[model samples]
Structure formats: structure tokens, C-alpha cells
Target: MGYYTQAARDVWTLLIELQPQTGDSGGGISRDEYISQVARDIQSKLPEVFDLDVIRKKLGLEISPTSVVLLQELERFNKLTLRMIRSLAELQRALAGEVGMSSELDEVARALFNGQIPVIWRKLAPDTLKSLGNWMIHFKRRHEQYSSWVDEGEPCVMWLSGLHIPESYLTALVQATCRKNGWPLDHSTLYTQVTHYRSEDEVKERPGQGCFVSGLYLEGADWDIEKGCLVRSKPRVLVSQLPILKIIPIEARRLKLQNTLRTPVYTTSMRRNAMGVGLVFEADLFTTKHISHWVLQGVMYGGRAIDSFDRRILTVYMDEYLGDFIFDTFQPFHFFHSDSGGGISRDEYISQVARDIQSKLPEVFDLDVIHKKWGLEISPTSVYCYESWNALTNSPSG
Candidate 1:
């Protein structure tokens, strides 16, 4: 079947299985009762789809002990599914008036519907889901890439962003490099080199030294295709698509940092909660000027692709001067219809976001700090600000 056909079938099966039974359907069940029944069904059946026993057997083909990392990631996925089930049950109870709804539970439901990994599972910074349809595409592509790696063995060029646990893949690369060179694995670190090819399909074979990886994005900066170096971000362009890169293991001391920015790379665009886990590694990007220039511009790298709106928000957050007035005039979006009672006040919303941002980066400043740093806060108020924010946050992206 075609990709869309298969996806539609899958989603249709899920909806049919989870559909509510009304009085006309012979169950005579209320909405709350239907939700409770669906929750129980999810708890029972969803986990079977994520069973790792079968996956473990497939990965066991690689007899190397390094396979443990991949196994652990599979285990993590199973655990996350369990957590999702429990959260759903909580939501069902809240809907039945047995308990109160919470922000966390609401977030879990949103993540599930949008086909994005929940923050509780990934422990990464919370991000805009954009739209259900857009994220489903990313989710499907991720699974396709992962299944190809598992079924066909390692590929000549890998889509690095597709893995559930990218750190495991990087570790495997390091181990293979060390074994090939007869070097101590503990003494080596990852090193990245940009390739001339802009796409993964251009490379037909695996490299002798390291693996070729694709699917990385440059935030707050752009890559100069001709110069093959870091450059200022194009006006109104939020992110730059990076070319294929080769990652190899090298001696720690052998690594050079002179005239290079040790750019921290994340698995996603949201970097706040990704310090230890979601942060894959640091890649050195060649720069002509001082490193502070990149830092002030908030130049960074991420593995996954974000929609245009997310790119715009990242730019606004990074460079206050770009959209001070626009950002100041905006309002927070209310996602839940039944729960949007008066909604959160603008100041309260800012404080909540500041707390979240501060928890991730204690040393840096918060959103309010952006206004102070730029000394620019224009309020071109709009009557439709709230509606505009909601539309931007939830609209489907291409």
C-alpha cells in the first residue's frame, strides 16, 4: 500500500477501536463512561504493540556487548508506553469527576494525539506540536528510518534524527571505530566533518573511518553552502538545513577547537530540558569571528526538523530585537476548550513560561530579560491576538 493509505488504515483502526458507544450503539453509555472504557482498553492493548522481546531477538544478531545500549532504549520505549497508559487513565478519572484535571495530563493527551513523544518520557524540553497531521508525518518518517536500520542492517548513510535514542547510535559508532583502530574507546570522542554532498542519497557507501549522518538543522545561524562555514542567519529565515556530515572517533587531545564554536547539538529544537539526555553531543562549527558572536546570536544545532512557526518563535526568543513588539503583544494560546475558563492572564502566562525556562537554564535570563536586554517593548495591540496565537500554535504545517 502507499504510505498515506497505510497510515490512514492505522489511524482508522485506532479510532474505530477507541470510538465511543452511545445509547443508539446499544451500550447506552455516557461520554465519561466511554472514556473510561477506552482508557482500560488502551492499558491492556497498547503495550503489546511496543513489546521489546521481539525487538531484542532481532538486535541480538549483533553479538557485541554494545547491543545493550539499543536494548535499553527499547526498554525505555516500553516504559514510556506504560506511562502513557497510566496518564490516560488519570484523564479518564478526571473526566468522570473522580479527580481534577492537571496540566501534565493535558500535555500527555496532546502529545499522544499529535504523535510526538511526551516530555515525561523523553524528558526533553516541551515544544510546540504544530499540528496533529504534521507531527504524524515526522513520526512516520522516524519509524520508517528506524525499521530500515533494524531490518536491513546499518545503511551506507543514516538518518540520525530517526532513532529513539540517538546517543546509543553514537556510542555504537564510537565502539566500532575503536575496535577497527585497536584504540581504547575511553580515550576517544566524537568528531564531525561536513561532506560536500548535501543529501544522504548522494553517498552510496559507508566510509572507512566513520558513519555518514544526515537530518540536522542549524538554528539562529545558517550554513554557507559555497563557503562551507557558519554565517549569519538569513533575514526572516529561522533555520538552515545542514548537509550530510561524517562522525568519527578521535583522541581527546587530537581534537582542535581553535577558531571553532563548540556548538551543542540537541535531538530537538527545544533545548531547555535536554541538557544530559536529549543533548546528543557537541559539534565544532568553523567560525571566522569570536565565539561570543555565535553565543549572543543563540546559534545552535538540532537533529529534528521543526515547522516554520516554531522556527519563527525560536528566532524571536533568541534575538529580542527581531520581534520585540510582536512578542510583547502576543497572548498565550488556550488549547483546551472545556477548560479555557477566562484563560490564563498574560502576566501569569509569562510567569509560568519563565519558571519553565528558568528550570532548564538557571544561569541564563528569562523571557522578561529579553525586553530589558533590548530596551525595546512596543505594544501594537490587536483585538484578534488570542485567536491568532491559537491558530499559529495549532495550524497544520507543510
Candidate 2:
């Protein structure tokens, strides 16, 4: 076995029994504190022979000394495992020159390494993270412009939650890469399949081989988890395989977006089609008055997610979009209102108009625009006031 795990009962037992009982156990809390201090005192009584300074200078690890019997047993098993792997590789490589060597090598390699890695971290590339951040900055600024048609009333926030494994997290990463770097094939296509093939590891109704695999194999990318083969046996993809998907470069390079370097993995994900559906929400026949026509096209910018296993990466991107959506949603067109000819004051109305112009049309952010366009010759405090006022009952008509 590559790794060992204690049974649930054994683990629970360990959790309950932390410390051993000793003689002279009286005043419980005071006794416990004294015991901890005494333990520390005992620990501090290290022999002068093993100086930490010298140890650090000479040692790479804090290895404990072992008896002859245990040392021999450990060394014996380690050598046996090492020899087993070397022998397995040799067997596979010897069969390399034969036909279908990739398949054979895959079989042997799986029989060897799957036992080694029992836990998968499911880590993301550092470059992917950086690119995603940059893409978000760009998306938010662009969405603000998209929000031009809507009124800024509330925050556009969407609540999403889920777990992301290795295979499916690719979709959001690819979409961010595309939108920021500007790729083709439409936004939704980022989650769709580019190239796919069925290997022996798949568990499905139609166990098609190679490119002749079933529709699901071509549906989207997968992480090749430990649960493949319908028997809960081993991971699907082998280390030797070059994976499966290959990107069409001419089409990928068609757009030539600026600042492509910001998102390093954008092209890589596109090439390998590492992307897929991240998250989705649905309502039974939910209709909105704003949408006039529903045209079903190839791939839409914000249509629907085809592969939503969890809330994972969807919210990371959608948070910004939804934020802008909510900000723009439910806004009254005639929001900037005040009593005419001063029941309250002429100054308050001018300030209201100034704020309306500032938020509604941010292009006129300049103080000069405030002075010129709205004709509001007021203090700078008028530029950004969040408060709304009630029109006074009494009117002062000139």
C-alpha cells in the first residue's frame, strides 16, 4: 500500500484519549497546568551533547534514531517498493516497440503509481490565478459600460457556492482568459468540447474507444478521478499520455487580442480545451419583461452554463457581472427629482442634478463638465451626495 489510514473507530478513540493517566492526580485544572509546565521542564532538560546550532549546520532533517530491528525492517520494505516500481517500468518499456505500446504502458503505469498518490490537492496554476485577476478588472470596467442602459440602484450580487475538482474548474479559467484576451468561438464555446476521445478508464453506457467514444466523452473535459472504470479502482489519465485535447492554433490566434501575456494560461487552456461549465441557476418558466426576444444562437455571452457541477468558479466571475446587473436593475428613469423654484432651496436641486449627471454619464467625470453641462455652479460637495430629499409642500413660484 502507498499510504495507510486508520479506521474511523480507531481515529475516534485517539481523539477521545489524548493524555495518559498518572499518579497523584488531584486538583484537576491546577494539576493539568502543573503537568504541562513539568512536561515542558522535562523537555528542556536536553543533553548538551546535541547542540541545535551544530545540528542545524550538519543536518537536513530532524530524523530520530531508531533501533537496529526497526531500521532494518523499514529499509527492507522501502527497497522492496523501489524495486517493484523499477521492475514495472522496465516491463512496460520492454513492451514499448510493440504495437499499442501507449495502451500497455498506461496499464503498467497505473498499476504502479496510483497507489502512491491517495490524495489530490486539485491545485491551480499561479499564472491562471494572475490572469483571472487581470481579466476580472477588465470585465468589471466593461460591465460598467454595459450597465449604461440600466439605472444604478442596488448592488448586483449573486449568491453561488460549490466544490471544484481538477477536471471541471477549467471552464471558468478558460472563459476569463478568453474575455480578457479576446478569443473567438463565442463565450459559451469555452465550456463546450473542442477535441475528445474515449479511453479505457471511462464509466458509461457506451464504452466507445478512442475518437469513436460516446457523446458524453465529447461533451466536455474531465479530471480523470480515482473513481473511473466503473469499479472505483484508479485514476483515469496516466502520466505518460499527452492528455487528449489539442487546440486549433489558427482559429485561436485569429483575434490577436492585446495584453495576451496578462493571462498566461488562456492560450494553453484553449489549446487543450481545459475549460468547461462552472455553475448554473434555473427557474421553471421564469420570464422577465425586459427581454423582448429570446434568440437561440450558437454560444451566448451570458446565456447558460452547460456543465455546472458546483458553485465553484462561477461566482468568481459572475459576482462582478451580477453586481453590475443589480446596480442597473430596478432603477427609475426619472430618479433625479427635486421641487422646482425652491420650496427647499435651489442649491439642493442643482446638487441632485449634478450627482445624476456624474453617475448616469461617467464620461463627464471632469469638474469642468459639472460646471459646463449641468450649469451647477455649486461647491464640490454637490459632486457626490448619496442622500435623496422630499419635495417641500410649500412652493415659492417667481
Candidate 3:
């Protein structure tokens, strides 16, 4: 007999023994009587580990595990008989090229040495695990041509996340490589796909055409254009078809202040500065009329009249204290009164302006060196104040 046929017969024998049996009071056991008897036996053994599903699958039976089966006077030995049947089936597969080391197989042998068989076996059913393991091993050893099937230009798509390389650099590199290889290059035909990373649970979709391509992903990092060095350890690649987005550089103005007063006094001043011309608001701030005016002055060097109280407070604090005294205490305080010509205390105004500025621009006022820089009369501050006031006055609605 063929090795496979012998294995199959062994498995079948084991299954037959596990089948439940029934007998009539008469000498001969009838099929219907046997089935009824087995059914009752199964019901009595309900909720036991001797599951019918496991038994059926092991025997390679066409019937469902839940289906009723008849056996003649052998119902009690079902579990033991089934196990024996499955073992013999496995032994047969092991002997044939269906399992184990076979000189005729190549792929199966490689798989066995590579430790993949154990992994597959662990996931398989108890009855099929051993045979499946041997089969895979045998197939690998006997099939040389089968192993190369994967190398036949099967399209492999890889998704990269956390890529930090710029799109331009990658596109340029690809273009350069194509030129060096004498490949026909189409710059206009470049296409890319992009997925924005938001959170761990968020799934990034594949990029479609017209998206940007940032860099060729190698290993876990984005490769540099010149030397192909990975810039970072994490595997991430940006795909964009458009020229890479350029980061706009911002120049921050630093001001130094000196405290000339024996007792530091609060000063207020209106700052009309156009500092945030190109910058967009990172977050929205809900300010009173006064605070809003100051914020606008800081951003556009102008005031919006939506909130007048906010504007008034901003104007008083910025012009008197922040722009003048706090910014440059060395310059003598020239104060004006509400009624017209009266000198106000530089110390009081400076303190008030400082407090106001702090409340409005908490981030800006949190600097340790601000006190030192505050006394330096810088051109930027002056320019900011001038622009703010001019913007306020020139407004048609103002």
C-alpha cells in the first residue's frame, strides 16, 4: 500500500473505534437501535472535554461533529478510539513525502531548518499539527522551483510611518538615480500617497496619486539624498508628489531691560507692533476689549474696536509702562494726566503695565531675563509701538 493510503487507513481505524454503539435486547444490533443508544450516551456525557467537533475533524469525516452516528456495542470507548485513529493518520503522513525530510523536496526542508514548522504546528489542531509540520518540511526540500515563485516580481507594498525626511530631497534622489541608470525619467509623472499620523489608534491610509513623496524608506529610517544615510532610527517615509513644503524661518527679536529705579514701579504703554505679519495664530484667545487691542497691536500692530475696554487698558499699559518705563527706565518718565498736564509716577504705571502684560501674554512674561531686557530701549519695540498706533488710526472703522 502507498504510505499515504496506509496513514489514511490508520486514522480511519481510530475514528471507527471512537464512534458510539448501541445494542438491542435481541442478539443482533440494529442500526436505528444503535444510533438511539449512542445519542442517549452522548447526552449523558454532556459538557465533557470529549468534544464531537474535535473527534470529527481528526477523522477527516464529511459529517458534522454534531451529527448523530451509530456504533454497534462500542459507545463507551469513543474517546480512546478516536485518539488512536488520529495518531495512525499522522504516522502515515510522516512516512510519505506528505510529512518529514524527503530528498525530493527542497522548500519543505528549508522550512523545517528555519523553525517555521513549529510555528505552524502550534497554531494547527492537535490531530493535524504533526502531519502538517512534516508536510511543510517535505515540500520545502523537494520543491526547488516553488521557492522561487515569490521572486517573480510579486508586488510588495510597504507602509512607513514616522518618516522625517523632506519630500524634495527624496524626489531629487530618485531622479538622480534614474538619470545615473539611464532610465527614462518623467518628473511630471511622479505620484505619491500620504497618511497623516494623529494617534496610536489612527490608521494611516495609503497615499494615492498627486500626493507628495518625501524619501525612500530604508530599514527603519528615512534615507538622505546624498549618501543614503538613514536620518533617524524610526521607519517613516513621507510620500508627496508636490515639491516639498519649505519651513518658513522666523527671526525673534530679543530685548534687554535694566531696572534703574531703587523700587521697581509699574509703567504702561501702547504697543503698536506689526510682528505677526506672516505668522498665523496657533490658538485663539478670548480677550476683553483692552486685552484684545493689545493682542492685535502685538500681532498686526493695530487695534480692533470690537472690545473698547480691552483696547483702553492695552493702550494705557503698553504706551505708559511696557513700551516706555519697563522697556527703558533710563529714559525719564514723561507722564500725562487724564485732565491734561500732570506727571504720573513712573513706578506705579510701570508696575501696572507689567501686571497687564503678564496677564495677557503669560508666555512672553515668564522669561527670567525679561527684567534685564526690559530696560533696554530697542528699535523693534519702538517700531512695533509706532506701527500699532498708525494701524489703529488708519483704520477706516476706527
User: Which residue pairs does candidate 1 place in steric collision?
Assistant: none
Q: How many backbone clashes does candidate 2 have?
A: 7
Give the per-residue lDDT digits (tens) of candidate 2, residues 80-169.
334434434444444443334455444333322221111111121111212222433432332342232123311121001111122222
The all-Cα superposition gives candidate 3 an RMSD in Å to the true structure of: 30.6
In model 3, what is the error at residue 141, expressed in angstroms?
25
- Model 3 poorest 10 in a row by lDDT: 260-269
The best candidate by lDDT is 1
Which pairs clash in the backbone of model 2? 156-322, 156-323, 156-326, 162-311, 170-275, 171-275, 171-276
Tens-digit per-residue lDDT, 1-398, candidate 3 = 12244467568656654544333424476543433343343334322224445444544654321122211101222343343334334433543447763342332222332323333233231122234335434323322211221233111122111111123223443444454445445532222222333222343332221222221212112323343222332333321121121111111122121221111001111211244222211211122223322232332223353233454466566565344333323344344433222355656767778999878862323333543565566578755865666676579975
Residue-pair clashes per prediction, in order, are 0, 7, 73
Candidate that scores best on TM-score: 1
User: What lDDT does the true structure give each of the candidates?
Assistant: 0.62, 0.29, 0.32
